[model samples]
Target chain A: MSQIFHPSTNTLSKVSIVSVVLLLGGLGYGLLALNRSPYVARTKIPFDQPVPFSHKHHVAGLGIDCRYCHTTVERTASAGMPTTETCMSCHSMIWTNAPMLEPVRQSWATGKSLEWTRVHDLPGFVYFNHSIHVNKGIGCASCHGRVDQMPLVHQENTLYMEWCLDCHRHPEKHIRPRDKVFEMAYQPPANQLELGAKLVKEYKVQKLTDCYTCHR
Target chain B: MKRLPWLLLIGGSMLMMGCRQDMHDQPRFRLNAATDLFGDRRAARPLVQGTVARGMLKTDTALWSGKVGNKNVDQFPFPITREVIERGRDRYNIFCSPCHGLTGHGDGMIVSRGLKKPPSYHTDALREQSVGHIYNVITNGNGSMMSYASRIPMRDRWAITAYVRVLQQSQNVKVSELTAEERRKLEGAQ
Candidate 1:
């Protein structure tokens, strides 16, 4: 082997300096790349809002139907939010003085929409049509965490793409009656495997096993 | 290792495609239901047919009123139960309560907002209406009321009519003669 020469003290220090500089350059590049592009994040973002609302009270306590507020869910792509007027129609007379409800009243008076914290959010690339899914009898609880039992609505589910496609690939696993849409802690029915299998066969639901469908 | 990684990636990629057409070959669940029993031939069989034989015997012809379309043809057979009532209540709350109000009093939130108030269930017109007529209204939808026939099954509508009657009776119970003990209980004498 060719003899590797021993360096002088100054030369050795220079090598160390170069190595440290290179390592730090690589690290700085990584962090800058991370900060610049949003791709490095491991968690989904939680949105903030003006007022806190509870699905638990209406759905669990009073048994108010899910369709009452999210009216267009069964027939339209977007489940329309409760307009300020919808709140004022009831809250105006029912809980006229509740401080939390003041924002709703204010929004109504100003003819402005409430900046409701979106609990169930999807990525911009993912095209989720609430109407089509609901019309096809896919329960709301299939994706949304049990909204009926939640007090201050937050994104209870991680809503990862994999979590969604799991059901899209095998909808039979999540098929249920339309009424159980808001029920939390609900499990796939006892005969779920069998029923899901039947639905899979009957509806001929094609599993979305393509990458481009999501990435695009 | 390269091949393994490539295969997994391909497999995972494949899972992200399609609308769920894979499990078609899986054995389907068989339910012992009447509807399923005749599932294959349901379309082949006619939905509603009236078979009538004009009387060769002359004296049997008699006048009829109210529902007189076909006396010779048998009435439709339906079984009403508590389960159906519960199911109807659930379905009604979801669909009907939006317009008709929770108590069927025409005071629902939608009505309060702008929608028209539907006919009261407490009225004698609704109380004495046949289950079939009520079913027709639900299926065909009356006035501003949209049809729920598609969303609610045939049996549940009958159950809803039954529940409506219960509501009417609750609202219109007349004060009548009571036994001594019953009167005491009514008077809260305990």
Candidate 2:
């Protein structure tokens, strides 16, 4: 009797086995890439807002300090969003008639809050504190990027556990002088590691890699 | 029929991988998050009228109101030190310098941008004004200036007031009061 299968059956079965493994591996990789993509993470993507607030104009041009509007950043867990009154503080005089600031005027007139789109919302479980970071010598530009240059704010870094751990593991790599924490154009000096090492010790920044550090 | 188990396994695994957001977005309100449950749609509720949180009752008329018995006090509630002055300088640069100018010349960037120029700190009227008066202006605002009470804390307002005094002194230093060494340094700049 003829063999149960053609002689080429051996090769076919062998090739199928390898191809199945390759296909599964590719799918796994694709899913991970998709998870980290801009679509999912919203990194570097600007969101539409009720008003076109420009950090570049306010921070770089007008030289307004971050704390001027985000008043509670240095003391509270949330970097407080400026109230409508904060906007009208300047807009009431400067851009009194600019149509671009109509929503601000409306909010001021109606006593309603402007619904600003959040840019750097982390997962709910992550217990991040801005005051601790700002007080511990982390410059605004370190994580927020050149906000002074961004016409519209966007997420400068991927809000990923791995990315956060990268800094939390070795905070010296990003630490700066406390005085320079709000400086938007701050640059790491030539002796960064040297200065950073000293600062890390002086600031007592712990390498908090434990799960509870962020998760709790 | 035999292949049904394999299909079910693959489909079940894909469904499981589709979502794990239960922990990522637990049912809780974050700061400033919008809510539909309230008529105002604000996650954060305004404090009720006359509601004072613990440790927030502002009873010190001198510190909170910058006045005692309806008169703005000339003395600060707390003693000023070098450290306090430095902190004042820091806070002043952030909140006050934008409209008041670094030298208190009333020509800050905001002034150039068309906001009414604030009065120079070196003006005789301002120089003679008590510290608490300035703090009151910051707390309650004056003329076109809006109230900064919500922006600057009580201690920081006093600190800024102290720094404003320093700026006034800096710009109005008497030439004869300069020491020989300081006068030489000033002359060398020219």
Every candidate's lDDT: 0.62, 0.91
Pairs with backbone N, CA or C atoms under 3 Å apart (clashes), candidate 2? none
What does candidate 1 score on TM?
0.48
lDDT (tens digit, per residue) of candidate 1 on A80-139: 676565565356556677898888888777754465544454555555678767755577
TM-score of chain B of each: 0.54, 0.91
**Model 2, range A7-46, lDDT digits (tens) per residue?**
8999999999999999999999999999899888898898
Reference contacts recovered by each candidate, as fractions? 0.10, 0.75
Index of the highest-TM-score prediction: 2
Q: What digit string (tens of lDDT, one per residue) describes model 2 on residues B155-178?
A: 999998999999999989888999
Alpha-carbon runs more than 4 Å astray in model 2: A1-27, B1-17
